[model samples]
Target: MLVAIGACYLDTILTTPYYPGEDEKLRATNVTRRRGGNCPNTLEVLQQLTSHESTDEELPLALITILPAKSSITSQQIRSAFRSRVNLDHCIYRDGFEEPASCYIIKSKSTGSRTIVNYNDLPEMSLEEFTGIANELGPKATWVHFEGRTPEMTLQFVRYLRKQFPSIQVSVEIEKPGRPGLQELAEEADVVFYAKTWAQNLGYRTAEECLREQSTRTHEASLLCCTWGQDGACALERGTEDFKHVAAYTTENFQVVDPIGAGDTFIAGMLYALNCKRKDWDLSKRLAFANRVAGMKVSQEGFKGLDRALLSFG
Candidate 1:
């Protein structure tokens, strides 16, 4: 089993400029809405990739995300969005909160570039809340991924899991650099994943530089991965003789509808392949599979039509 921890949100996306200034507004050329956020999006991809194995296999992936607050229409939409992919047995529904977190995304019609505005209503999960569920899933989980939205809570969860199951691998996705006490968490992680942008934000010129600096300074992490959009991804393992670079796959000339969740999908594909014990040389195959899913997502209006594309990847 693999566990992902972070926020889940309802995403509203517009493909054209909705407004230029306070007085001027523009109509969108395209629009989309979907269930999004770090954990949910990543887990949805993992679930899609892992859920159809033979019954003799271990239980499929599990997620530990907070459900939307009671009585919110967004909650219903969120539940419905992931109904097919997630098991619901591992989900937690909070009673008194007013609304779930949400993201408003704007994409440039010509460039496929996007900007996001987010609103979060779910508070960080307490240690007690996580440990109860971790105890149930820990023994089964081979790997756990954490997106740094709730670093303090995530660190506590990692600590508990390490104490309970020392062998289980923990991967941390560092979305931002300035989170308080994040370095401490990075030192404890087995793998640290970051996008090229995040690596740049940390004052490193390249991913290799970032990983080398982190490995030298902390010495606790084993692996560091940096993803470069369309360029490829690179990984450096501590105590290894050299770095490994996996080039991005070439796709048939196709249009990009939305690149919003491409990175998350790529991570999911990588995790799926890794967990399934696929060859490292096949990493590009997994990335290509993810890119295909992301391409299909953009061509459509929402995240609803991905089941076929995601499952079609062998």
Candidate 2:
């Protein structure tokens, strides 16, 4: 089973001609509403990729996420949006709260680049609650992915998972900056994925350089990876100074309708490959496979065409 833990939000995406000027009103070329978050996006793609892998038994998936305590329209939308196979019984609903929402403005006619304005007022998963779920999933869990929310709590939870279930692979996405204990989580994770823009903000010039620097610091992780939009993705293992770069599959003949969740899709592809194939793949081949999957993602919008995208890969 692949277990994902993090925040889930209702995302409203708007496609505009160009970024608006200060206090200037503009009309959107297109609009889409969906459930989007690091964990959910990864989980959705993973589900699509692994759905038909075997016929004997179902590949189980469980998503541990936060939601509103009271059943509201947004919460209902999230519930309806999840794939039928995803187990959502473990979701924690915040008392008397509404789900957080994010708005993305994509300059579709110009650069296809996006600007995200989000409201994250929901409470984070508590350490005790996290431990409870981990204990239940100890035997059946094959992989667990986390979004770095409360860093200190996340570190403690990951450490407990390592001590209790050493065989299960643990991966963390560290896109958010300035959170305490993030480095500690990186140190404990089996795999770490960093966002290119976030890494650049920390004074790194490129994703390869970021991977090299992070590879030196992580004591536990053997694989350190990063994603660069349009520039493709790169990775380096522990004790390796050189990075293996995978070129992004071009969208030359296709339109990039929405590129919002491509990174999460890439991570999901990587995890699916690693779980099914283990170490049979080299770093570059694994990265290349993920690159292809992400390329398939951007060629379409949202997760609507994801199944077709994965099948096209076959």
Candidate 3:
């Protein structure tokens, strides 16, 4: 099973008509609340995509995340959402903090572009938490995936894990770059996945450029992947002949209801495809699958628009 570690947020997304003037007040047409946060979102998508044909077996995925002692969301809600697909034997429910972190996402009616206002009071998971979970789950986990929002904390956790067990493969999703002490973490990651926006945030023209710069500076992981919306994705493997480009799937006729978690869904699809050990499928194939998953996600109105059919392994 793949183990994903990171924070989980509850997202509040609003869809409304565009207002032309600053003085004009706009009315929201729709609103949605759903589970979010990079790692859980991606892991959830993976779970949906890799469901078994029969109900007898569980999906080959697990999530290790933090939750408050008492949640507005009921225990049944949590169980119904993830327990079937993910092995939560190492999960924790701690007694600190307010309601889970949440985001206020706004989508423009005219352009379909989105703006998000997020609120988070993330409590850093301690080393003891990491070691305890790792000791229990590391031996059985084939892959460890972390979303790079918590750089220092995640780096320390991953570094410790690698030192204790160098055999497991580790993948990192670099959501925000230019973070202090990030280069060291990059050097230790087995694979790095990034988006164009993160590259721009780091002052690079593109994600590929950022990856190239990292390769020049560090003797880190060999594989770098950059996901581009609509246009598709690109990958650079160390010592490989050249860079590989993956084209996005066509979505000309689909109606896009929401696009909030598309990128996370795309990453989940890629990870799922990789874990399936489909060596015959190239990077392009993976990206195509990812693009399809993302496009399908946007066609739905809420986060729960994700269903078993979208994640069909068949």
Winning candidate number (TM-score): 2
Clashes of 1: 1
Query: Model 1: residues >4 Å from true position, as ranges?
Result: 17-23, 57-59, 70-72, 83-85, 278-314
- Lowest-scoring 10 consecutive residues by lDDT in candidate 3? 305-314
Residue-wise lDDT of candidate 2 within 1-314, one digit each (tens)? 88999888778788888888889899997888788888899888888877867764446788999888647777778888887879888888787786555544454568778888778777788888988888877789888888887878888888888889889888998887666677778888989999876788788888988887788778889798899887889988775654689888775686676688898998988987787645566677778878888888888777755655456554
lDDT of 2 at 2: 85
lDDT of 1: 0.71
Q: Top model by lDDT, which number?
A: 2
Which candidate would rank higher by TM-score, 1 or 3? 3
lDDT of 2 at 31: 83
Off by over 4 Å in 2: 56-58, 101-108, 239-242, 308-314
Cα deviation at 279, candidate 1, in Å, is 6.4
Candidate 1 structure quality by residue, lDDT tens digits, 78-180: 7777655565566677788758877998787766688789987676678888888888775777888888766777888888988999988898887675777
Task: Estimate the TM-score for candidate 2.
Answer: 0.92
Evaluated against the true structure, the overall lDDT of model 3 is 0.71
